[model samples]
Every structure is written in structure tokens, then in C-alpha cells.
Target: MGATPVQAAEDGRVNRDKLRELIGRMTLEEKVGQLFVMRVYGHSATAPDQVDIDHNLEEIGVRSAAELIAKYHVGGIIYFAWAHNTRDPHQIADLSNGIQKSGLQQTTPVPLLISTDQEHGIVCRVGKPATLMPGAMALGAGGSTSDARRAAKIAGAELAAVGIRQNYAPVADVNVNPANPVIGVRSFGADPQAVAELVAAQVKGYQSGGVAATSKHFPGHGDTATDSHTGIPYIHHTREQWQELDAPPFEAAIAAGIDSIMTAHIVVPALDAAEDPATLSPPILTGILREQLGYDGVVVTDSLGMQGVRTKYGDDRVPVLALKAGVDQLLNPPDLAVAWNAVLAAVRGGELTEARLDESILRILELKARRGLFKQPYVTHKGVDRVVGTRSHLASADRIAEATTTLLVNEGGALPLSRRRQPNLLVVGADPASPSGSTGPPTTVLAKALTELGFTATALSTGTAPTAAKIDEAVAAASGKDAVIVGTYNVAAGSAQSTLVSRLAATGVPVVTVAIRNPYDVAQLSGQKATLAAYSWTDVELRAAARVIAGKAEPEGRLPVPVQRADDPTRTLYPIGYGLSY
Candidate 1:
């Protein structure tokens, strides 16, 4: 007896037809299951935190992966391998397979969607480790959309090889505010048009390479000074502000056929005065995202447990409210049962309609089917060792690191420090921590490269009080030497290096300040002979900076942001598009 087409369809992975058929057959409960995306940790119990009596306290750890899927029939899973948990990429792969297997055990043959936040090649879950590409700002510094696309391709290929079908990345927020914490490194740059183009390329790169890309923090998180994860942050800008800066990249991404849009928990008072928070606000998600911007793809939320929502809505009810607000999937809710029950309660109480649940479920199923989850024989037993941190990928990462380094300032031929009988070099900056946490390279990777070029180098560690006297001593040490390089690490969050930069630049020995964080610091060091902004402390930037200083490489890096005059507090520390070549 030959098999019927329906039977063959049933055996194969989910496609559009299969998804439609499954949706038609699903009960209300099944439909609701597809709307919930939960965080999953593998079999290990003692993870994320010291085996707290309550395991799911931290964002990284969760209740057993099996329990969540088996009980709730979750639509998707977001993977994050925090430090405490088993960091093995293969272990994560095994866990991913385990999730699918658990999903298949359900009465309905729905495949679970697996995702991760592999925004940069450094942030990936699978494949041989590649170089941590410079954050968006570095690509902006490189002054090319192609660099952004190349970065996305590397990140996508690495993630997809490990079965991460969805990547919640390419943060589309503009980095306009220097005081803005948590977003400086993540955003591409401050320029709206440049950010839009680069983000669109990133989306294209991820999707084309098989990993679904998500343009994040819609409306925008750019202008705000607060961190959404910490509290209820609001973008005080008006509708005009949003239309010009915050809304551009999102529009570009949607136009580029982005697979998903993740809503930030930010509130834009200009858009919706009442119920301003975007995550649970209907006006923002439905009215603006769906109706105005015309984004028809899946809408996912930032972690529900973040204080932006949780502190405001409490842990129990936020998930259900998010669904009512039109978010198709929730990211990392507090409790799966609590969230699921809340959804059920909402459905029973008429707060959430079955029709609404079906809409989200159908979309999820469509996405899964689109991913070939229903038709294919999913083999989760991928030996992760072969794919994770492969040599070829690592080499590419090195190249990206090298190419993305931008030289912000060089004056009076002060750079390209002498290689033979080299001038005395003083290095100060990032902890020389290797991947193994061993003191790898001091003074950023670029400083290490300078050492290799034969510069006699001295590293002055930036202590709590980075004083002018210590800098003067270093300058005195190199009294007859050709140059003094002060590598400052004050850009990224958790920095205490700004004092050192100011102190060192004060000593007049042809001082050059290398800023690997914000380019604004260039204005702070106008008294110095030269200032450089590499935007990040990644190894690649380190090497590029070394080459540029040693005169081995030309200073081709243009300022991605404005360079403020060092003395101008009223003016931007650095105006956008300010860079120097000597």
C-alpha cells in the first residue's frame, strides 16, 4: 500500500501547507503554546548561580528544559551560555536537540524554535570561534556598509551551523547619546542613515546565510540615558525625533525583509503618553509597528523578567499582558508555569481571546514550517566539537579584527613608533586576559603588536587613582625615546580609565591618546599631540592601532562620530565624522 500525500506531509518537516493543516487541527491550548517563547537550560541543575534553592533566579539558568517544553509546549527557546553553566558549545547543541525531542513528544508534531543572541561573531553559540568583530561603531568607523554585512555573514554562518535558527540581534538603536549605557558598543553608530544602511546589511547577511535576524529595540532606545534592563526607561524625544532617528533603521530592516522585530521595553512619551511602555503598550506595538510602519513580521519582546516590565507589572501577569499587547513571543519570562497559567487565565477570562492566541501560534508555526522543522529529520546529535571554534573561522575573525580598526588621530608623524632600537613605549588599558583568563596582552592587542615591532614598552596599570604624576614619570622614562602611547579604555560600560587619559595627556612629551571606546574622548585630549579612537578594545583594533602607530599601516580610519573639542563641554566631546591622518 502506497502512502498518501497527507501521510508523507505528516512525516516531513513543517512547511506552509503542513503549518496550515496543523493550525486547523490544533486546540485552543495548542495554539496558545506557540505564542510563548521560554528560556531553557540543559539537564544540569547547578547552574547560573550557586544552586540556589530557587534555580531560575538568574536570567541564565532556568528550570529543566524538558519540564518547560513537555508541560507548556513552548513555541521557541532562546539560548544563552552564561559563565556558571556548562560553557561547552556541544553541550548546548545536545540541549537544543533535547528540546526538539521533547517537543516531538507532545501530541501535536510541532517543532520548537531555537534562538540565541549571537549579534556579533563573538556572541555566537556554535562553530569554531571567530574573532569578536568590532561592535557596530567600529564598522561605522571603517566607513562602509560592506564591513557590517561581512560581520553579519560571519555571525550568521557561525550561529546557523549549530541549529540556532533565530538570532535576536543587529540592534538597530542609534547611539546618539554618549551617556547612554549598555548601547554604545551594541549600536552601529549615531548617524541615522548610516545606522539604517548598516543594520539592513546585517539583516540581509544573517537571513541570507540561513539564520533569521531580528532588528531590535523598535521605536528606539537611542536617545534614552537609562538601561531598560534596570528600570522603566523612556525616550523623551517627540514624534519628530523618532521619525528622524529612531525609526529609520527599523524601516530599512523591514524593507529588507527582516525576519523579526524585538520590542525594547522603552517608553516613548512622544508616541503614547498614556501607557507609554512599548512592550505592553498597544499603540506602539500594534498602532505604530503594525499599522504605521507596516511591519508584518513576527514581534518578539525583550526579556519579560527585565525590570523595565517586571518591576512595573510584577512577574506573574506581564507575559499575558504582553500577548494582549500583540507581542507574538515573550523572551525569558520569570516562570514558565506562572506565565502559561496567566495566558490560560486571560483566555478563560476573555482578557485574551482564542482568536488572538491562534494568530500568534499560526505565525510561529508558519516560521517553523518555513524553517523546514516539520519536514526534516532533525538530528540534534551534531558533534559540536567539529563545528565550534574551527580554525578557518578564527582566522577570519582575526582579519575582521585587523580590518575594522580605525585610526582616529595622528599628528606630526608621531605614530608608526620605531621598530628597531624602538622609542620607549608605555602601555595602559585593557587587562591582558586571554580567552583562558590568563593575562594575555596588556595595553589592548595593538600594544602587544607594538612590542613585537621592537618598541621597548612599559605598561603602567590604570589604578583607581590614575594621576598626572604617574603619567609624568612614564613620560620621563621615555625622556629621550621617540614616542609615548597612552591607551585609554574608557568607552564601554564599567570603565574607570578616563582619569588616566586626562592625566597622561597633560604630560607634554608628544603624547598620543588611543581611545577604544567613545570617540568623544578625543575632544578631552586636544592638548595632546594626537588622539585615536578605535571604538572597541577587541584584538583586531589593537593590531590595527599598533600598525597605524608604527607607520606599518596608513591611518585610514575616519571618525564614525563627531569629534568634540576637548575643552567644549557645551559642545559634543567629539562631533560626528571627525578623524585625522598624519
Candidate 2:
């Protein structure tokens, strides 16, 4: 039987009766606004008609964020660094408070759900002085649910302190393809059960830290070769394989009572023969996620502007179809007027009934109440920095990063080098700058770390493809050096880093190549003196790698995913749990 009003209120902590009456009183335009989670341009809630980096008056057709809320009655706002919404902790809190103030001042006064993609490791939108934990795959390598939970709790707590209530995090993709460009290091691991356990733990951890947790890219975006942001990738998993590989993490999420699930924009031809993205397919989102998975919580579509959703449907039809497919929140449509009016028109044209929207609106309102936003949504600006990047939080992040140091190959006690023996070290190789615009490459960070540890380390920033001159320069630099370390990022068997490593190994200076991004490069650099997988090039990870080199810390991480054979992608060079200890 369905829950009674009192039972429902107890279960979801929402005043269902009040929300229902409010919905009955809502105008058609206001009801339509409750369905969208839009993006606005600025750092301030209300601003003058001026132009700046983030405040483009021409683009938004409004002065500030408050104007967007008043003009369109958007239910939520998502922040991006490019939008200049997160300049710092205090600013973010002020902006969030301002947005909530305007949202509550409306005629129908609904509090906005403020959100960001604070996925922590490579995908983090909120940068330092916020504590940045080692991301998902690093936790997979650490092989501890407690560690994963603790890291997530810290990250979620910092976001909450700043009034960001929703974080699109704990990516449950279960990456199995070594060649998958987008989700390689973002996923937990290739093992479905392992990923499931970590995903469930992270869900509880994030919620306990005071925000809603979203397990995203539903129905398994793990094996796709194409990124959904640029092109729609098809997953050819048979029904049986999908059951084995793709279904477990989401099932675990639902079992954990996750607050929301975001739909992937890919198509699984086996699940539904139609070529429509899962964002618009009834069979996939409703038949599978709603009925089979038994998830009645808020269902959000991935960004509508992504190429994955734009392939089949026009801009007008995308939002309406997604709503028809049972998605509660339409996220980030490029054209606000077109998508918003299309959804409004669909309800008026009788293609969509108001009852369908009420189902979603009630769930959204219930979520806000469950999060305790209705009572106290504002955050003091001064309190933001006290909780964001505290010493304990930074220490916890360091512990997680140090634990993810996986030593792939250590020949004859090659690692744990003595500072006295390896005093003069040459650090060179591809140090790709962070896509998120972090400080210099891993090479520079490692050199700086070693110097801090009382080692005279010389850094040579060789591009990934070392030119003839750079190669010769690195080789000359390696001559007579006590030891040499090279950082490689996602190098294939015959790739440029592979060629560079072969040349450096000939120097007989104990060359160690650390896999900074993709650990699959292990198969390519197997002949080095030693290889370590730090999983990411973030400063914390590199500093941990440096400590291990200086005999200060132990390498505790193992390969989360199997290392694919360089020549043949079907086989593995090393198993998932393979890592050497010094």
C-alpha cells in the first residue's frame, strides 16, 4: 500500500500536504519553472548592467543571477568556474545566500537548490583552499570503503559549509574499457561488486556530510569509447552482461536510498532498439530505472547541451521528451526560452499532463525539505573558510593520496632510494599541465617535493613528444646522475613516451617512470627500473610519490583496473590487485 500522509512525512521528512496545496495554487508558468535547473552568468545575485569576464549582459539578457531567478523562476542553479560563480569560499557562500534570498522572495517563494560538479579529483569545480581529495579511481586503488567514505564526507562537508547543497559526485561508472578517454580515472574500478560497495559507502558519506548525493551516468557509461559530451556512444552489452557489469552499482545506490540519480545520454541497443538517448527513452528511464530498479527519487537528465542529447531531438523537443521519460530535473539546456517554453507548451497542448509535473515537483520539494533547507538555508560568510580546508581535512586528503601510491614494478630494491645514494636526481618527462589549470606538471611538482625532502633534484620539462633536441638534452642531463625519474601520461606501446623511456633506460641511471594519469601505460614502460601509478597528477598525489621515492612512505595502492597488454587490448599485463611493496 502507498504511504499515508503522516507516514510519508516521516519517511521523506517533507510536509507533503503543504506542498500539494502549494502546487494546486501554483500558476502554469510557475509550475513549469519548478522543473528546470538552469545556469546563469555572474558572481553576484544582483548587479548593474555592466560587462565583465563572467558578467556578460549581452549573453544572459539580464543584469545578475537574481534577475534570472525573477525573470524565469528557475528551481535551481548549477555553478561552473567558467561562470565565475566560485571565486572563493566566502564569495560562494555570499552568492548562495543571495540566490536563496531572491528565490524565497518570489510570489510563490520556493528555495533554489544550489549545486556544483565538486567531483574532487580531475573533475573538481571548487578548487583550493578547499580540500581536494584523491578522486574515485585513487580510492579504488586504496581498496578501502572506509577511506572512500571518509574522503567523500570531507569533500561533501566543505561544499555544504559554503551553501552548495547538491554535489554531482561519486561517479559509479565501473570503468572496464582501458581505452575509454572520459571515464578512465574518474570511475572506481572495473569490478562491479567493488564499485557497488564503494558507491554505497560514498552515498551515505556524502549525505551524512549534509548535502544530496547523485550517482550519475546511469545504465553504465563504463565501456563506451566516445565521450557523451561530444558524441553519443553506444554500449553493446548484452542483457546478461549489462546485468553483470552495469546494474550492480545503481542497485547499491538505490539500496542506500540515494537522493538522486542522473541519466546517461548514451544508448544501449540491447535494452531498447530505438536510437534515442536514454534521456528521452521511456523504456530505459522508466521501464528500467523506475520499475526494474525501483527508484522513485528525483531523476535528473545530464546537461541538455551535450552532444549526446542533441543528436536525435531538436532543442524544443529534448526537455519535453526527457520529462515524458520520467526525469524530474531538466539540467543546463543551452536555450532557456526555447526549452522552457517548449515544456510549458507541452503541458498546455495536452501532450503532458499537469499531474506528471506534480509528481516530480512534489519529489523536488520533498528533497529540499528533507535537506532542511526550508528552515535554515542561509550560511554565514565568515563560517565558510573555517570548514573548507582545515588542517585536519588536508591531512585526511594527504592520507588518502599517500595510500593510493601503487608501485607497479620495483626491480631488485630499486625503490625506497636513500637520499645519500641518490642525492643528485634528474627528473624529466611529460608533465602535462592540468586541464583544470593546476600548477605546473608532475615533473615540476615532484622536483619541488624532492628538494623539500633534502634532495638536489633537477627538473627538465620535456613535452610528451620529446623532440630530437629535448631527447638529447634529457639524455645528456641523465649522464652521471645518481638516479633519473620520468613522468609519463597515457603512453601507448610505440608512443613518444615509450620511445623516450627506452632511451632513458639506456642511461643505466635507474630510470623510474611514474604513470601520472592512466596506469595502463605500465604495459608500455615495463622495462624501466621501476614504475609507480600515482593515479593522478594532483599535487597531493605527486607529493606522495615523492615521499615513497625518498623512503618516507610505503606504497599501499594496487591497480584498480587491470593493465591492458600494450600490443593486445584484450589481455592484461598485470591483474587488478597487483602492486609491489618496497
Candidate 3:
């Protein structure tokens, strides 16, 4: 006998008859609308009406997000930092409910797949009150798939409580290149197998917590030096090389039944000879991803507004090309109406067949159904408040942070600063302003935590990077201190901060360097008496780092990425899985 055919129900369960009925009822415009995911600002009353044209198409400006839903019928909505204007859980829930309610008011009334880039750790788009968990690298450093699963579950539950059905997270990229500016700490680790194991575990946890997990920047964006948000990154690797290095995690994601897979905006000439990005390349998206890898889930493009896609294809052509290249959904199109109309025109002109459009729409609809969004599209305010940033979740985050604090170097045994002696410590480099736009843990919090641990701690910031004069001033201030702890955020990018630490280490005083963002900072300040990797500057992680420094807690994390020595870039000082305890 043949295999039984599955069905989809109106509530988005497996009821094939209902799915066929709904798809048959959708018009061409509605089908085209299902291919685009647009962005919305805060819950402000003012409608965005500023219009401009690029490449012979008028940009779509709206008075409100409701207008976009009612008029264009977008398939989904992605929230950015702007949309999360307030940190209040109830207010954020109300915003999500409002967006979903507006979609219901539309003629077709298909529920929107509300999504956000809540990849906790360094890349949290949604601001405060959301439990700040460690990033992917931190999970890998912790060396436990169970921690990855637990952290993802907590994050997924918090997001789901706010009516978010999808999280564009658990980046599958393997950060093999230390110079990789964009994906360093975001990736789980440098080893493909390790990343695969952790990625699969996170996928299961996210799905178990009721949010659809999206394995992102598919194939991989780990080995490049460029940021896709700014420009196109080229990856030079043969097909076999890519499969061995970058394909494992994505394969694991598919095996774990991830609901969505996002396309990278980078160019891989080995995959496709064309200069076009993966987001617009048929060979990369359709041929390799669909045919070779056998990813049958909804394939989404990275933000269409990114320079990687926008610079090559204008606003008018991006959506059409993306749809033609087998993308199921266009994320953050430059102009929603223009992109929607262009797709409609493509189908009408036979440039894209109605059957082709339906293929993606069906996948998207299936995902919505699988997520049970059709059943409960809105979340209650009380539910959001109760689950989001709950005490238990925060405690989990704290434990994860502490578990991921790595002691990379402690030659002089500067750590576990003798509590009985009560060292007079001067803490520096806790910049409140994160260069990545993330609100990191404040310097005051670290100082307060240390003070509570019976140390006389003083906190100071040299902004992002301190100058020579500022370094000299800091050294003078540290003249009488028993120990100096310098917090470095993204030291890989800031040479001045590294120099300041080096100068402090040269002063012959005990200097403990804490890398607050990337673990690679240890390579620059290897001369320090002690070096620690926190991986994130969030409140929980900073407090955990302080606790480890004071011997209140032990460092348990291993290094996730290789660190090149400061004196020799060719030599790796600390390889993956290298860490120490007091």
C-alpha cells in the first residue's frame, strides 16, 4: 500500500483536506502576500509615510503596521530593537497581541508568524527584562549540550509567552576564522561536529518550549571576515571542504526537524559561479539546499534590506529574484508593497508560476499550523508577565553564565583573590555603551558584586578604548591597589583596549584581564597574571565572573574558539576545550 497522505486542519494541525481548501480559496494577491515578512517600529500611533523611489519603483510607506497587514496581507512580522520600545513584559505582550489582532481583522485572516532574532547572548535584538542568557560560543565553552538545551528552552518559553512563534537563532556557523568579525562569539564553536551536537540540542529545546526553531544563515556564515549587514562576504571553499566544515550543523538541524532555515547573504563561488548572494542564487538556494541537502522546510532570506542583497539587487528586483531562487519568505523587504506587487506581477507575467508560489506558501502555512498559531494567535498579558524573565528562568540563566566562565590563564594565581586578605581592587573597562548596540552589564554591577564578596572594589570606564594618557591615569590610580581587573569588551576590534591592558601588565602589578565579549582577547593580553573569558557582558555573566574571581564560584567553561598568540598570529595559544579552575 502507498504511504498515507497527511492533512492539515483550520487550527493549523495535520488536516490535509482543510489545507487544500484554504489554499484553493486564496487568490493570487493573497498567495503573493504570503511570501513577504515586513518590519514594524514601536506601538506608536504615527504612520510612516515618507516615500522614496529606487530603481523605478515607489517605496511603500505606511501610516501604521495595521495598514500593511490589512492592505498587503504580509505572511509574518519580525520585531527589531525599535519595536521593543519598552522593557515591560506586559507592554511587549500587548504589542504582539495587537499585531496579531490586526492580522485577524484582514479579509483572509491567516495568523502572522511573529518572529524575532532572540539568539540570546551577544545578538539579542529585544532589549531589557528579557533574560539575558549566554551566547552560542558560551554554550560550547560550557561543554555540555544539556546547558544549550536548557538555555534555549528558557529563551523559547519566554518568547512564546509573548506570542512569538519563531526564533531566528542557534546560529549553525562554525567560527573557524578568528578574524571573522561578524560570527565569532555567535557561533557555538570551531568544530563542525561540536556545533552540530549543540545546534541539534538547541533545536529540540526551542521546539519543546513551543517556539519554532530556525537554523540560521544556512550552509554557514562562520568563516568569513565581512558582516552581511554591511557588505557581502565571500567564502572560498570547495564543495567537499564546505560539506566537511560547514554543513554538519545544518544537517543536524534538519535531522532535528527545525521548522525554518534562513539563507545567508554571502557569496560562495564554489556553490555558484555568479556574483549574486546565496539569497538570490538559484544554484545555492534551490539546487544545493533543496535538492542536495533535502531541506523541505520554509526557506527564508536574510534581511532584504541588508547591504549584501540591497547593493546588488535593487528594491524592485530583490523580492522577485529571491522568490525565483526558491526563497519561501522575504524578510524585511526594503519596501513591502513594492516587493509584494513585484511578486504578483512576476506570477501574472509567467516569470514565476502560480504553482511555484504555492509551493512556498504551503510550506509557510504548514509551519504556522505546526506552531499552533491558528489556534491561539494572541497571548494574555498575565501569561507574558508570568513566564517572561521569571525567577526560575533568571536562575537558570545565572547558572548557565557561571558554568560558562572560563579561566584561560592564571600563571600568577591572581584569581580567587584571597578573601581573607580583602584585596583593594581597581576594576576598569566596563563600558556601559556596547559598540554592538547591546546593553551590557554595567561596571557598577560588577563592583557591587565584588564588594558583596568582601573586596573593596572601585569601578571605572575608559569609554570603549582608553588612550595612552587615560591608560597612564588608570595605572596611576591603580598604584595603591592590591589587584587590578580590566574588563575588555570586543577587544579583538579595539586595539587601544588591548594596548591599555598590555601597558598595565608591563607595570609589574597583578592584572587580571576579563574578556567580556570574545574569548580571543586573551591572545592580546597573555602577559597578564590572570585571564578569564566571560563571553558576554550581561548582568548575570558579569556577576558570575566576579564570583569566580573572588573564589565564591569555580570557573567551569572551556574555550570554544582557538586564540592566536599576541606575538605570533600563526600560533594558537589556547585551543578549543582549554580552560582552568582554581
Task: Tell me the tens digit of each residue's lDDT in model 2 across 1-582.
Answer: 111122224444677888788778778888898888877766778752245424445555566788888888888999888777887888888888889888878887778889888776678778778888887888899999998899888888889898888888879898999889789989999999999999999998898888899998888899988999999999999989999999999999999989989999999998888868989989889999999999999988899999999989899999999999889999989888889999999999999999999999998888777776776778885677678989999999888888888998989989977786548989998877573435567788899999898788999988888887898899999988888899998887678778788888887788888888888888887468889998888888888899988889999998889987777777778999999887
Clashes of 3: 8
Q: Looking at model 2, which ten-residue stretch has the lowest summed lDDT? A: 1-10
Candidate 2 ranges with C-alpha deviation above 4 Å:
1-12, 48-58, 435-439
Evaluated against the true structure, the overall lDDT of model 3 is: 0.81
Cα lDDT of model 3 by residue, 393-460, tens digit: 88898888888999988885778789888889888875845422334445666777899889999887
Q: What TM-score does prediction 2 earn?
A: 0.95
What are the TM-scores, per candidate, against the unseen true structure? 0.86, 0.95, 0.93
RMSD of 1: 4.4
Looking at model 2, residue 439 earns an lDDT score of 59
- lDDT scores of the candidates, listed in order: 0.67, 0.85, 0.81
Report the lDDT tens digits of candidate 1 across residue range 1-582: 111122223433334555567777776677777887776544332222334324553532345666666667778877765422225555555555666766777777677888877665223333223335566777777767776787777667655555667888899999887777767757778899989999999999888666778999887888778888898887888788889989999999999989899998887887877854788888889988999989878899988878888766766678877887779988877676677778888898998888787778767766665555555424343534454456765565555555555556566666656576667777765442232211245364555678776776666655333556764555456455456676665433223355555454556556777776666655444446667666655565666677777777666666656654444446764456655565
Sort the predicted structures by TM-score, highest score first: 2, 3, 1
